[model samples]
Target chain A: MNFFFGIQNNLFSSKLEIPIFKNDGTFLEETILYKLKIQDLEWKIEIFDKSKKNNFFFHVNSSDVNNNDIFFIGRHENLKKFKSNKLIVLNEFTSLVPHGYHYRSNLRVNINKGGFSSYQSDYPYKMTPVKGSVVTSLASVTNFNADKNYIFFKNIYELPIQENFKIYIVDLKEKKIKTFFEAKTNYSNFFEIKKEYILPEMFLVSKNYVGIPIYISEKNGQISMEHTNPPTSNILNSDRIDIVKKFKRELNEIIN
Target chain B: MKSLIRKIINLDFSIQVRNTLNIIPKGIQKKVSNQSSTSDAFIWRTDNNFTTKFKFSDILKLYFKIKKSHVELHFYSKFNNLITIKKIYDLDFSNEVVISKNLLGGIEDYGVFYAYHIMDEKKSQNISVNNKCYTGFSKDKEFYSFVHGNTLVRTFDYYTNNQNELVQTSFIKNKNYLIQKFFYSSEKNELFFTNPASKSVKFDINGKNFKLKKGHSKLISINDNFVKIRSNCFYFRPIAFTYNEKYFDVYHC
Candidate 1:
C-alpha cells in the first residue's frame, strides 16, 4: 500500500513565502511547518538574493525537528546577507484524503525595553498552477495611526517571470474608483494609504491578477498584520460560483 | 472491477451520499428564494480587557436595487448560551458592529456570534444572502487586529426558520489532527477554540485534555512551540493570540 501511494503521485504542492521586513529593532523570523497525516512528506526552503540574481536552497538542522513539526529559524548573521529578500517554503503532500499540513512564517520584533510584537505570515501561494488571470479580491483598511499604517502587497509566482498589474481602491461611500498603485509580480510592494483616502466604506480591488493584500499597522511598538478573504468566501452554497460571477461582473461594471 | 474496488476503498460512496443529502433540501425548497443564505460563526471577545468588532458591507446591493436590508447578530455566551440577538437595520454599503458588554446586556466574556443577512425579498433579488465580514480585536484601544471568518460553520434557512449546524463529525475519526507551531519566547500564547457542533466536542492540545460543550468556547495557553490537537470534529482550527508584553497579535491558525 505504501509503495502504491508513493508511486501514485497524488500530491499537490503548496508553496508560501514572505519578504523579511527591514527594522532597526531586533528582528527574528522562522518558518514553522506542522505535520499532519501526510506520510513521508518532503519539503524544502529557498532564499532569494536581494539582488534577485541567485537562489539558494538549504536544509534545516536536525535538532530543530520536534516531535511533530519542523522549525527553520533564521540566523541574524545569515539573514543579513539577503536583507529584504524572500524566504520560501515548498511542501508537497497528498491531499487526496481530508487531512493536510500547515505552515507559516513567524516573525518577532523587539524595538525598545519591554516592547515586542509577533506576526505570522498570511499569504499562501495563489499564482501557481495558473488558475486564471482575473480575480475579484476585497480587504479592509486599518488606519488606526495614519502615519504608521502601510499596506503590503506580496505577489509571488511559481515561475520566475514577472507581470505588471494595477490595484484599484474603491470608495463605496464616495462612489468612486482610483488606481491606488501598480505592482509587479514576483516582488514585494509596500505603500502608505493616505489618511484622506481611508474611510469606512473603503476596500481594495484587483482586476488584473490575484495577490495577497496584507494590512500592517504599527503604533509605539506594537505591529499587526492581517490578510483578506477571497470574494467567494461570502457564499457557502454549491451555486456560489455562479453567484460570485454575477457579483464580480456587477462590481467591475460599477468600478469601470 | 479493480477501479470500482479502489473507489469504494476511498470512501467515494460516502462522500457522494453526503453531498447529495446536503443539496436535497435546497432543491426541495428552491421555490423559496429568500431561504438561501450564507453565514459564518464569528468570534466575539469582551473579556480580559479585549474588545471585538465586526465590519461588513451590503454586497448584495451591488447586484440588486435593495429596498431594505439588515444584519442579525446572534450573540452567545461563553457557556454556549444564547445571550442576545442584535439587529442592525438600514445598513449602508459599509457598516460595523462593535461587540461590547453593554451591547450584549453586560455579558462580559468571550464567545461566538453568528451573523447573517436579512433582506426584504419583495423589493430585492436575493442572489447572495450573506456577508462574511471581518472581525477586529483590540486591547486597551491601542490598535485593532482584524481577521475574516475561517469556516462556514452554520447557516439559517429563512423560509423554513431552521438553523443548520454544519461543523460536526467526519466519516473517519482519529485520522485527522490540527497542529500549529508557536515560539515559546512570547509572554503569552493562547489558542481560542469554539465548538460549532450541536453536540460536545473532545480534543486535546499536546497531552492536555479538553471538552467543549456545544456552541461553547475555550481558551488554552501554550508554552511550547510544538502543539498538536486531535478532535472528534471536522473543522477544529483555532484562533491564535500571542502576546508579548504590551504587543499582541490575533489570527486564525
Candidate 2:
C-alpha cells in the first residue's frame, strides 16, 4: 500500500550523525545497525575525530556487507571504523522511497558493556547536506547529578573546510544568551554544560550551519542518549508553522 | 483530477478532516475542542525497585512569555483509574516531580500520566497550552533513564471554565502496523504498551493476541528479537526496557 498524504516535491537524502563516545569504562563498545532496503545500496560513511588531523572516509555497499541486510559500522574486524574516542559517523544515503524519503530509513546505535547496554534510534535528518541552522529546546536534560551529560554536535561540509561556529545557550530566566562553546564544522564536537548553566528554559541555537544536537547522559553503567525535537514539533495544529517561525525569530533576536 | 484521486486512495480526506477539527479555536465548541486538545500522554513506572520522575518546563511561557502558568499532572493506575492529581504553581525555568509508590498513595506498579499547561485564558487565547515533557525511570536509587512522551492522549480544557471536563481523544484503529526490533539476549527484555484510544484496542504481537482497554497500560516480556504490532491505531509505539541484572536501558520504539 502506497500512501502519499503529505508528500512534498523535493526529495531529501538521509543523513544521521551517530556519536562515538570515549570507551572510558563507561562506554566499552559502540555499534551502528543500519537496515538496508535496496540491494547494492551505496553509502558514504565518514569518521570525524578532533584528535586526528584528517578525517577518514569509507565507501560502503550493501552487497559487500556480510550480515544479512544489516550493516554494522563499528568495532568490526573487516571494517575498522572507530579510530579515536569522541568520534562520529556521518552516514548518508539516498532514500529508496521517492515520496516519503525522510521517514523510510531507520538507524539504531548501541553501546554496551558486559550485560549492561543502552540503545537509541538516530531518527533526526537534514534536508541539505550542509549550511542549515538548528534551534531546539534542551528541556529534557536529566537532573540527576550522578548522570554525566554532554551535547554532541555534528556538521557536514565539503573537503578543505576551515570554519568555526558559535553555539548560543539561551537562558530563559535571565533573558540572556551566551556562547557556550566554539565548534568546527565537518567534525564531531562534544562538550559538557556546567551544572550552573543547565537551568530551566535553556535552549541551544545554531545560526549559520545545520547539525544535530544529541543529549548524552551516563550514570554508573547505564547511558541514555536522545535528540530533542525541533521547536515546531511542540504544536500539532495548522498554526504550528507560523507559531514556530515567530518563536525562532524571537530567539534569533535574543541571541543577536 | 489525478492528484485528487491519489489523495483519495491515500485516505487524505480523513486526515484533513481530523486536522480541521483540531484547529477550531478552543472554547468555541467546548466538547469537540476539549476532546481534540493537543496534550501529550506519557507512560510512568513505579515498582518496589524502580520509580519514575517527570521533568518539564514552562514551554508556553518560554515561547509566548506569559506571566503566570501552572502545570497539572493527572496520574492513572494500570486499571485506568484516577490515582491523584498534582498541580505545580509558581512556574520556574525547570521543574521535576518524582512518582514513587509512596507518592501515588502506594499504588500498583505502572500507569499513564499527562500534563496540562494552565494559563490565563485571555493570555493564552491563540497559543498552544500543551507541554510535551520527559519521563525518567530510576531503579534502586540509581541513575534515571529518561524518554519523552510518545503520543497525544488526553487533556482538561481550562479555558472553557470547566476544569472538571476531561477530554479523551479517540484513536483510529486502522490496517496500519508499526514494527520495532530488539536485541534478544540472556537478560530480560520487556515491552510496555499503553492504549490511547477511547475504546479497547486489540493488537497482535508476533502472532500473540492482546487487548488493552482505554487509558490502560500493560508490560509483557518478549523472547523474540523483534515485535510487529498490527493494530487499528497508526501510531501505537511501545516503550522498551532491557535489563541485565542492575543495569538497564529505556527508550521508545
Fraction of native A-B contacts kept, per candidate: 0.27, 0.31
lDDT per residue (tens digit) for residues B1-253 in model 1: 9999656533434443443343211111122235455566788988888888787766556444464767788988878789988998877766677787788888668989888777666333345455567888887554677776766666676666577665544332342343423335546888899986665777777768888877888888888655667666656778888776666777776
lDDT of 1 by residue, A1-256 (tens): 0000000001111122222221111122332222211122223233322221111112222222222222233443433333123323332121112223233444333333333333444334334334233333333536445236666665654443456776677765565785467866544556666666556556676655666666666666565556665666765445777776776665556456
Model 2 lDDT per residue over B1-253, tens place: 9999655533434443442344321111123242123455677787647888888767666666776767888888888899898989888767888888888997748888878777644552556545567778887555677777645566555456343322222233333333323345676888888876555677777678888887888998888754566664435667888787767777766
Report residue A216 deviation for candidate 2 (angstroms): 1.0
Clashes of 2: 4
Number of residue pairs clashing in candidate 1, backbone atoms closer than 3 angstroms, sequence gap of 3 or more or interchain: 0
Window of ten residues with lowest summed lDDT in model 2 chain B: B23-32
lDDT, residue B120, model 2: 46
**For each candidate, what is the lDDT?**
0.55, 0.55
Q: Tell me the lDDT of model 2 at A200.
A: 65
**TM-scores of the candidates, chain A only:** 0.55, 0.55
In the order shown, the candidates' Cα RMSDs to the true structure are 11.4, 11.4
